[model samples]
Target: MVIEENECILLQHRTDEDNWCIPGGVMEIGETFEETVKRETFEETGLEVNGLELFGIYSGESCFVQ
Candidate 1:
């Protein structure tokens, strides 16, 4: 999500599910995770990002699977 200087995040409202979520999507073919992040961010929020770093990786049963 694109967080502004005020610490507000860019969230998408899902009409089908009636929920709000951070902008993200599945990784495309031959695309790296960082590339997917950049593309999804732009596609959803119309913003470009740089200087990405490792934050955390979630797995296990509780995590969503594509």
Candidate 2:
């Protein structure tokens, strides 16, 4: 997440779920992780992001989160 100097984080509101959340989406074919992050972030928030640190990777059939 992008944290400003004031320590406020950037989050997106999900209209369908009626809640606030960290913006993310499924990766596209042939896209690098960085490319996916940049594309998804801009698509969700209309903000461009550069220099992302590798965070946790999670996967499993039961890994669903809301």
Candidate 3:
């Protein structure tokens, strides 16, 4: 999910690790990609979001999996 305001983007500061990244998480069972985005964004940032659009898709071994 991309949250842009005034040309700035939203990023999450991770508490468990020393890094800043875009807010996201693993998809729950039976959840679509968009649902996962909405759920994770709210879980991480307390924001309720809609009007989702595809930003990109990544695959292959270099992608993170959990």
Candidate 4:
């Protein structure tokens, strides 16, 4: 998820892949969704965020592969 403020958003650039994308990663065992978001955002962007709300949850056949 990208944090938006004043119509601007935060993104991370992947030097290995040479692409820009939202900062995120797989959730660790025993970590809540919010905790995962905060940890990934900090790891990728060096920024700390708080007061997060659940945005949306996506899951379906189209989101995965057989």
Q: Pick the candidate with the highest lDDT.
A: 3
Candidate 1 local lDDT, 1-66, one digit each (tens): 444457776788877889998877766789987898899988877888887765655556776567
Q: Return the TM-score for candidate 2, rounded to 2 decimals.
A: 0.79
Q: Distance (Å) between predicted and true CA of 48, model 1?
A: 1.7
List clashing residue pairs in candidate 3.
none
Provide the global lDDT of candidate 3 against the true structure.
0.86
Q: RMSD, model 3, all Cα superposed? A: 1.6
49: Cα error in model 3, Å:
0.8
For candidate 4, the lDDT comes to 0.85
Which window of 10 residues has the lowest lDDT sum in candidate 3?
57-66
In candidate 1, which residue ranges exceed 4 Å CA deviation? 1-4, 59-66
Per-residue CA lDDT of candidate 2, range 1-66, in tens?
A: 452437778888999999998888877789988898899989999998886887766567676645
Candidate 4 structure quality by residue, lDDT tens digits, 1-66: 779889998988899999999887777779989998999999989999997878886657765634
- Which 10 consecutive residues of model 1 have the lowest summed lDDT? 1-10
Instruction: State the weakest 10-residue window (summed lDDT) of model 2.
Output: 1-10
lDDT of 3 by residue, 1-66 (tens): 678779998999998997999888777789989988999999999999887889886657786687
Better of 3 and 4 by lDDT: 3
Q: Rate the local accuracy (lDDT) of all candidates.
A: 0.75, 0.79, 0.86, 0.85
